[model samples]
Target: MSHTIIVGIDGSDNAQCALKWAISHAQKTDSQIRLISAYTVPGVNMSQADIVYPADFDAAVKKTIEDTAEAAAASVTEAGVPVSTTIVPGDASGVMVEHSKTADLAVVGARGRGGFAGRLLGSVALAMPAHSHCPTVVIPSTWPTRVMPDAPLPIDLPVRASGARTAEADGRDRPDFSGEIVAAVDPFETDTPVLRAAAAQAAIYGTPLRLVGVTATHILAPEWMPSEDHLVKMYDEAAKSFDAAVESLRADFPDLEVRYSIFDAPATEVLVSATYTADLAVIGSRGRGGFVSTILGSTSQGVLSHAVCPVRVVRVTRRQPGRRR
Candidate 1:
């Protein structure tokens, strides 16, 4: 089945990167790409001086939005993917969330034009995964190398904020692009949207699916210390659950290669580490540990901020009983 993928654009290098990623995914999945750019009226303070507005102010704004969307759509057309453009007037995040209700996937950059050097994620990037009705993919600023190695880097490289250092200056290691799709699955939880998405991505890219789970370790409190036997039981149950999940996934995708490992550490840390070598990392919007109704779980938040690879947040919510296009 063909899918409808939404690409949010804002004329930022990061958003351009997102467009590239979305086009590539669309080519692979035989999906259509919808390019959306949101615009808001300029909020200028007119208390000091009386400023006369131009007669064609609204027309100028609409023209600008149309041009921006068209420019982004050019890339999608060149990639031979069916594309549509929508210029909406609203907050970028709100626009994306509203459209995501019918989109198969939503893609955006980790940072946008207004992102501060110290900020790892842009406001839209943070909000989409939490409130999107479909899976939301956040492409990192450093993703060009993985998707298009020969392509030139964006000209407008962001300058570091005061007291900030570059990744190379801090001795950061680059990702290896191991060509495997990784999923941070909750073994004890029966939710399979994350797993199914990861498997489908793996198939699309012709890569192996790596299922990584983390077992909770004992917590130390002033008055309570968990017994060794209790910890052992928990670990054993987690192992069994992991095995069952792996078996089920293997059965579902018979010809696909599926592997799994359980780590005895925090979920966010382990998953973040796994992203260094993964082609893409798929995860659920929320997990079992935090608030039951959290729009975005703490673990997913941490990984999205720091993961070296593109992270897809799969949110399982009640549907309206039919698909949109």
Candidate 2:
């Protein structure tokens, strides 16, 4: 796939942060930036019942968005990445989702100036991952504040890639540190694709793939595990799944340094803890057990909200009758 990354801008601080994050990523991957600034004609806009619509109101709104896109393009150009900007005439979320269908990745700020002004997570950030055609990354407001000119590429990987960083925060935090990439899984029927996504990411970064399978031991097993012996057998089965998954990735990328971990704790807790040391946390949008949900599963949401590193929530697109993975 071409390295095309789409990011949203709204003249908000968080949106600017997302744009800069995208620039940094493009620099690392030698990708192109498609900076999009979406504008909407407000319901109570000047054309309301009591007010006269200013002749220049529409032009002004378009100009403002155009300027935002131009400035974003300038920044990317200065950073040595080729960029393309667009002043989309529509709602932000819908415009982004539409572009996501043809892009390799889509990124959004945790929150922007919209519906709920003071909320930490915004409507667009929450909406994209669940509906995007590719992986969507939501950059938090509290990002690693390293100077852009001084930032280094993620690591020594042959594949072009971009990911999150655990900020010690360039002196803002007393101790800055680097971290790994964690691929979270449930080892259940639904998450095999999640595992593949994580493995692909690990391959891209040349990072050690950490396959963390989390489960709560006290939770009652299904009817098939009616006895303690059956429970033991289930545990053994899970261990085998863990190893097999790792082996599968190793088979694909012989040099990949993979690790297997099983924790008898909540899936959210394990993945969040992993994020502290992970540059990126990869998870499926749906799974069984704690991750059982339609789209944007509870477990995935927990990690997205709490992870110290950037999280990539990939939608496991089920194969259609005549489609490919």
Candidate closest to the true structure, highest lDDT: 1
- Candidate 2 per-residue lDDT over residues 1-325, each given as its tens digit: 4499998888788788788878877776778989878886665654547776687888888998888778888988999888898776887888888999888888887778842123546778877888888888877665654223243223211011123223443434211124456777665332376677777677667677766665556465565434667656665666677767666665567887766555555677667666655677777776666554667777777766666567778776433111112
Pick by TM-score: which candidate is best? 1
Q: Can you tell me which runs of candidate 1 are displaced by over 4 Å? A: 48-53, 114-119, 146-177, 218-233, 290-293, 317-325
Q: Count the clashes in each prediction.
A: 0, 0
Report lDDT (CA) for all predictions: 0.72, 0.67
Superposed Cα deviation of residue 139, candidate 1 (Å):
0.7
